[model samples]
Target chain A: MNKSIFYHAGCTVCVSAEHDIVKLVGSENVTIINIGEQKSKISEAENSGVVSVPALVRPNGNVLHINFGAAISDLK
Target chain B: MNKSIFYHAGCTVCVSAEHDIVKLVGSENVTIINIGEQKSKISEAENSGVVSVPALVRPNGNVLHINFGAAISDLK
Candidate 1:
């Protein structure tokens, strides 16, 4: 699955949600990118229709925006 | 000493720098505030002349802005 998680550095919600994402998807299966540290990723995230941090991109290329609870359930 | 560490949540540099700050200040002596999560702290940090994240406010009311290396050296 080409799964990626886009997050910003100083977002508390992102930090907290990431723990659960890693647990649910396993660390190796997900590509976690911090947009704050890597500005290039911002374009990629924007292209995927993600305007905010803590977004998840599914293997099917669908962008899940901020609903970490729903994203986790969808991933499961 | 009224020591506080002002940081933004999604800052990778802040994340790395905080580890060093915590080690130097011993967690108990420092108040680590995430400005992104707590907007009120922004004004407090600004009052101390802190314009960016990863700033260290010394007990003397001096703000060390973004100079984590210098801050650590001064703390030690």
Candidate 2:
């Protein structure tokens, strides 16, 4: 299965969401891209249609905008 | 003086920061760019070295990464 792209920014909200998402999809199933530390990833995130951090790009190329206080059960 | 560029994502944190920043420099002194609503501005935000939302680009072209709970007085 293709690894889902997880665009992170290292912020508190992003960090928590990352943990939740990893648990939901398993770390091996997700590719964590820290755009905050790697500015080059900013363009990659933009290309994925991520205007903000804590975004998830599924294997099918579906983009999910995870906002603050997002519940793990709400993740798809 | 040139208008400072403010990169926003329309999130709660970004909205609060926008309010505080506009108050600090006044609306006339800052140009708000909502990358969330206007995905086209994502490139502009990336160009300004903004990996996260609530970023401020001073008139001199210095980038400020504003995180959650950032003190308004700390803005420069």
Candidate 3:
């Protein structure tokens, strides 16, 4: 748990998390990355092993924990 | 109906989707966005309202239909 939490919020994740996760954890604890604009960034996140929206960049920064696409349930 | 589909894959979603969604939908129909690198694009994806990993941008280009992170079932 030494990694920085990086969230790649797309449309669905943003709308849901903005109204859900953001409220649950607050924006302060997380880094929300709007990944719908850049092709390179998106690629980078994937290379980092990111596969979904609302992902939690593990404290160690080794793996990403996805909150599911437009997750109906929370990742935590 | 005019909307373009976008995928913001983090680590979890990527690992799962690479074996799940990617295999189901293949990589051509979807444009995966690795949002773990650039901070700006992450914000952009959020603005687009993308909320999921395997999100389907409606042909109308209004709402994003997320495929859910690490989806067990296919979006189609």
Q: Give me the candidate number with maximum lDDT.
A: 2
Residue-level lDDT of model 3, residues A12-65, one tens digit each, is 645554344343334665555666554446666666666666555544444434
Docking class of 3: incorrect
Best by TM-score: 2
Report, for candidate 3, the interface RMSD: 10.3
Stretches of candidate 1 off by over 4 Å are A67-76, B1-76
Worst 10 residues of 2 chain B by lDDT: B67-76
Q: After TM-score superposition, what is the CA distance of residue A19 in candidate 1 from its true location, in Å?
A: 0.4
Error of 2 at B9 (Å): 24
TM-score of each: 0.41, 0.44, 0.36
What DockQ does each listed candidate score?
0.02, 0.02, 0.03
TM-score of chain A of 3: 0.56
TM-score for chain B of all predictions: 0.74, 0.83, 0.50
Please write out the lDDT profile of model 2 over residues A1-76, one tens digit for every residue. 5788888777788886677556545688789987777877777777766666677776665555555432222331
lDDT of each: 0.56, 0.67, 0.47
Taking the true A–B contacts (Cα pairs closer than 8 Å), what share appears in each candidate? 0.00, 0.00, 0.00
